[model samples]
Target: MADEVQHLTRAFSGLGGLGVDEPAMVSALARWRGQPEKRSGFRKGFPGFFSSHGEMERCEEEYMLRLAAEFARLKNLVVLWAMHPWERDARLAHHVLHQHHPAAIVVEVACTRSADELLGARRAYQALYHHSLEEDVAYRARDKPYCNLLVGLVSAYRYEGPRVNEEAARAEAEALGAAVKSAAGGKLLAENGDVVRILSTRSKPHLVETLRRYKEIHGRRLEEDLSGRGREETTTLLLEAVLCLTAPAKYFSQVMEVALREGADEHEKDALTRVAVTRSEHDMDEIRAAYEEQFGAKLEDAIAARAHGHYRDALLSLVMGAHHHHQ
Candidate 1:
């Protein structure tokens, strides 16, 4: 870690103290990675130029290490920039599945639930990773209860029309309520399939109507009732997925609220990146409005208060419509 810090500090400073820009340094590192032989002489001579002071003797080794780390870091940034939004989301989802981190999976599914978006993401996954997204999820996501729910969500091709059958919504709402009630024990219930199918296959417009009917019929919000039962991981994901589908703007606003809060950690930074990159082109404007309405703080102001460096500038620009990639 100390070595990494030293390398990052110098790499951030300039390439070998030549005062080169980050872009230039990144370019040079790309070239070096492609042609390491070209740098063999410099790498060999690095030890000879150590400072006369013993402290300076360590500089050459550190410099080389820093160069390598910076090269990898910049390369990653390049890949991130080059990726389409769907590809980025696929990679993020693939990582989440493999690592067993399911917190953001529902949000990801919500963002891509529309027919065109989900199809594009699946294609992007195949193009980038040479494998189907569903296949990967089935293989990597070992936790059975939530895995089926996630797979069902991604695989669903819901009707996109706004025309919802009110009678059906009311009836299905009751069915869902009964399904939740049937899961009386803490153990997994067969009725969970009903919950997953209802949540996954329903259209956003239809689902919203169903949730409204659910609340009216049960005299409680769907999410609250789900939580009140305290079922399992699958149920938890179901609630989050339902909320994101029904009110994405408010859901994302709460995501940003937690991300920009004081004492936030790297997880917050990552969450901010996911939402900003994915939604910028989709519902960013709605998210921004929701952010201000819910938190009483402008999205840009909140991001500016918490972020810094080029990252901060990039985020601010995305939020304020200075970039095409942002929503």
Candidate 2:
């Protein structure tokens, strides 16, 4: 048993030479300490090392399990440390929103967070990437169909209050309905600015009221009105944005469903990673509930089916562990 403990200690000591970046490696070492210390913590329960053959085998098994856990922690920390958190999120947002050729993902993230959180993410982007989030959005958005609209949506600093203006909601509901009706036949004009202004400027409470009024006045949900209108891609994208902003949990649940579906492509799996990492610390419970309700399976089962290797293990740690202590 003594020989086994010494061998394991040497093995762990040798891992220090992996020589990754300082912060990530340091974090991994810290977690290693936290998890491995439990081995030492439980030592009093057992007789001293070299007690018996059976005891030595039990000790070896316990050490191996703890080491596996520590390795998992180190692997996850390395991925998290690869970039600044905001930069990572910015890249994911860019991939989901821009590279994918639509802006609903950007709108979902921007609109879902409180104003301060959105501003903080932008600041992190500027600090790490040396450009504002809006700057990147503006540069990419220029000359696109919904360029101004996308730019406006990302740039918005909507009021984070609960206040709802009944009159404004009613008026804007009519404006939105009229804008949708005018957008038929894929004919877009600068007048789509009305839709942009209403979506980007309104508070969540106010927007919900406007959408409810839109349904009452137009005899259809705003999204239903927008859909099947023979509109262009930008108009359809804008509809997705409105739906996500209106019900973020439902939107993300749908995202997860596609990402976790059998034979899901790499992009879909990447979307799952982004959603898992970003929402793990926030509303994963709500997202998971939404997933189960929508797909009739636990999110964990879906992840286990699609993900493989350390990627699978790390994501499961985030999704299943519910311990969001990422540094």
Candidate 3:
């Protein structure tokens, strides 16, 4: 482990020179991709190793800037992939809070992650920015329904056990249906505490059963009911949260489809890199299968047609699990 750390330090040191050794960096990163202990060791040892020169921050900034100038997407991908997962998610949450339609990213992080992972992200957010994620989200989304929904999500710490109450789930499903119905009929969704409470507090298995009961009772999916009305931001956000919690693979595959479409703007296209990098080890195979089933084309083929050069190579490496190799 000590020798591996030293090797990684030396390999990363090359980034401060005139040009980046792309192959060397890729090889080192790939070797450590799935080795969580080694990556944790690298993070702990990096600052200590570089602090002697007092150039750690400068080197990182310069390297990132150079990469941004040449390959903006690659810069984002590399920075996110190299960080500890908690810090990576914290940074992503901070960034997307300032962008348009921040609901998707916020909901993704809140709903898709395990309870401990979400808590870790919140701790990292506080450590990095000196503010809690819930507080920041509340401040940014000052409106009634948006603030309520976003805050509830970030502050949640649901139970992770397999036990679920079918009776309570059925009742909660009715409550949720009533809330949506009231919201549609001119009530403020923020006033519907049942909606936020059930969503933010219920265990995943409980929620899944509730959603199934919702369809059984209401004769339609909750998402379908939400979309049958107009495309209000709050309604859309609610739909996204439900989909993320219930069917993450489908939600992610839909995001990738949008990112890979013709003439996609920078924000839209960035979703590809985000989803690929974050889900690579956890569930990339599920996402890839979902993508092919939904879009009727291979994800790798779509990426090859759209992305170019080393950016393409890095993304493919991640998506295909090539990064797990020692090289």
Candidate 4:
């Protein structure tokens, strides 16, 4: 897979965009010295070695520790990147979570941003300790977006989407292709928001058209490339969602399928929650309609009897919410 995915690139970049950059807030959130003498606030999250800041750093643990303060302090993320390095740094992830701290901000940032950077940091972190970073990340994430981001990014690679066309489609297609082509094959674009932002700011229609043309020339099918490789029904559902390009019906399929499988485990439940919460912000009515026809029931009816907990609540609310073209 690595060799076949040569010149791969990240389709989405959560780090590149700065809807709001607040550094003061980030600094405020940093409890660097808030812990007892030996235990800094960032301790406890580390294992294999000393869980102290001095221990991790003395061990040269390469990672970033972000503070909620970063988002609050400034509008831009580049500042937060300062604590995080252009290179992989897991010390950042380890310390912040401090033993019982929900999680250090480094891991959270890794969850949402570049997996290559995260993996690099994780590897660096592990090499110092002689273990797998992947295992550590899993145990720490519990069941939430942090887990989703980390797992998704690690698995992310060069994924070709179905063809698209727009006025700027040509420019956007090339730009997107170039970004991926230039990257090491290890990165993932889990956050498609950045990708869309870059492409759609131009002319969306042209972008779609450009996708169609690029695929013709390179034999790259974004839809198949993104989700088609995996055999699981969920993977197929993701492929369809990416393929939807317009309706986002794949989100619906994923939600319904979760109920059909393993009775919707906690992990599956969060994804369902997000779809319900996120889709309305992105024109989910089409998904709602698709749900009725494809699944043989309104999405609400489908989950009403089978799902439970806050996760189930979030999904139903999202399905019921008014469709607002973009979240």
Task: Summarize candidate 2's per-residue lDDT along 222-302 as a digit string, tens digits.
Answer: 877667655676756677678667877777888888876665554554466667677776778888888899888988777
The Cα local distance difference test for each model comes to 0.66, 0.66, 0.78, 0.43
Weakest ten-residue segment in model 2 by summed lDDT: 13-22
Tell me the TM-score of each prediction against the true structure.
Answer: 0.72, 0.68, 0.76, 0.34
Off by over 4 Å in 3: 1-70, 99-101, 322-327
Q: In candidate 1, which residue ranges exceed 4 Å CA deviation?
A: 1-82, 110-112, 187-191, 229-232, 322-327
When 1 and 3 are scored with lDDT, the better candidate is 3
Model 3 Cα shift for residue 229 (angstroms): 2.1
List model 1 lDDT by residue over 216-319, tens digit each: 99999888876775656666666678778788888888878887766555455456766776677678899999999988888887776555444555556656
**Which candidate comes out best when scored by TM-score?**
3
Give the alpha carbon lDDT tens digit for every residue of 68-171 in model 4: 22122222222232433422245445543335433323323332333354456666766665655556656666554335544443333222344444545656
lDDT of 3: 0.78
Clashes of each: 2, 0, 0, 52
Angstrom error of the Cα, residue 168, model 1: value is 1.2
TM-score between model 1 and native: 0.72
- Residue 171 displacement (Å), model 3: 0.6
